[model samples]
Target: MASRALRAVVAVSTLLAAFTPASAQEAVVNVYTFRQPDLIKPALDAFTTETGIRTEVLFVDKGLEDRIAAEGENSPADVIVTVDIARLSAAKAKGVTQALEDETVNSNIPASYRDPENHWFGLTKRARVFYAYNARVPEKVMSYAALSDPRWKGRLCSRSGQHEHNLALFSAAILHWGEQRTEEWLRGIKANLSAAPSGMERDQVKAIAEGRCDLAIGNADQVGFMQTNARSPEQQEWAKAIHIVFPLFENGATHVNIAGAALARYAPHRDNAVKLIQFLSSPRGQQIMAEQNFEYPVEPRLKASTVVQSFGPLTADALLMDEIENTRQLASEIVGRIGYDNGPER
Candidate 1:
């Protein structure tokens, strides 16, 4: 009878151990991200290896803010990772994220790349660059303002004007050129579209290859991905057909967008989330992110991937990202007001 009782007790204990919460059993951080999993796997894996804290990510292509809001206090999200200042600002505005006050995070990221309130921190940056067909537009250097010239009329392609990428870029334009000029500029770009703004940045590049357009606006990393054969072999041929031109404002600096993160307001593992954020901004984490994603690291000390560097040095515009966030709504409004997505004005 004593032996039987001991056996039963052991079984009960094993069952309890098996049912224990994952966090209690071992460290884990849950991430809700707009970024794709494959793009960030290396960084997450390195974080887990370094800190023994595993990461589980949920990739939401859209409606990330709404989902987090719906989950409320019970949200399993410990961190939020996304691209563009607009999305990060949207998360903060939705009250789904809390301010981070960690010294490590503050030290690793520059003031320009982090929220003044510490709501989010940028991990990497990608310049908003122009890709011109080698056979069509020969000049290696170009300006964003030049894209509006009548000479390039009906020769340009872009993704939807309302895309977060373009919105952020337009926001910067608004800040630099003010509303009236930016509006006029949008109309000019609208006049130049080869087709309706119908696809992503990659499609714009493809458009250039197909002779649908001679020049297109896209992020530098997309160009890097193509140049490095990160996509299909055919894409390498497409990449070969174009030349990357870093477009600058009249002020002589190029617009840039960031891939960034924030701590969830209702993080279940707040401490672990802090650790992850710090690790992401650390030298090792920054290196992993920059190399894997083909983006420039937010840490000035780190170098961008070889493919990105081959494009030449980038002088990022000094405009405050917060200012861009402030103007994003107006930027979207202007895109709509000009019928920028309906293709060339008819």
Candidate 2:
């Protein structure tokens, strides 16, 4: 009887421990993200609910690369997410992230949307579209290269050249047109600025509505957000003033950038981190991203959000996403030399 009691006690204690919250089950993954919180919260919620892996986010408005570089290998970050190829390539080049060996990631993500060396994968592909003042500019000005026609001088508004979004577009031009043609394009676009380079992208759209300029360069998601917002009358006005124009290269493909992720070099939860990466890149998570955030999924064949699809089918730029590693530095030099910040009248 005593022996039976002892066995039962041992079994009960073991069962209780197995069911209890232990360190393993309570593990947290640190994520460093450049995306606005609202954009990624739903996906984050689903990830935690499904896997029981807790998440902690550190949001950076600027200097993310410097922050991550400072942390070095001791960084608590398990994953890093951001938009544009320049920043992602910067992280990979700085050794802040490590190449992953997950077969699921390789299989689920298209080769075009991922690093050739497997260091990062693009989550969504967004076109660098133009936002034109519909009432002021004619539909005939559909091509991006048409912005340089001199007829629109002092009728354009843009974010500063230092902004990553602008830099990525310029980099794409450099890849497609070479330095000389790209320089000429930049010089001509500079000849058309309506105002000095100033303000955020949303502000650029607002400027268009207010008659500060007849056209601007902006991302598609921002336009969707503005048009759909319930409270802001100005957003509706901005939406009304603008129509999107997708630019095509000589080969007839549009330039695209992405929101993407990489595993940190010192990720403590290595296996779980890889699992989460795979999950996000998979068809299921990509769909969730599209539905929740208006982001186009990197997985081919999946329809994007209704708003994304409304922009119509896109033939994205065929350049490797990682080529920013080579293009960014040169782009910076070229942008300054061409005086993008000094305005068109310069």
- Top-scoring candidate (lDDT): 1
lDDT of 1 by residue, 49-140 (tens): 99999888888898898888986876778899998998999999999999999999999998999899999999998799999999989998
Count of residue pairs whose backbone atoms collide, per candidate: 0, 1
Clashes of 1: 0
Per-model RMSD to reference: 7.0, 9.5
Name the TM-score of candidate 2. 0.88
lDDT of 2: 0.79
Query: Which 10-residue window of candidate 2 scores lowest in summed lDDT?
Result: 16-25
- C-alpha lDDT of all candidate models, in order: 0.88, 0.79
Give the poorly placed runs of model 2, Cα more than 4 Å off: 1-27
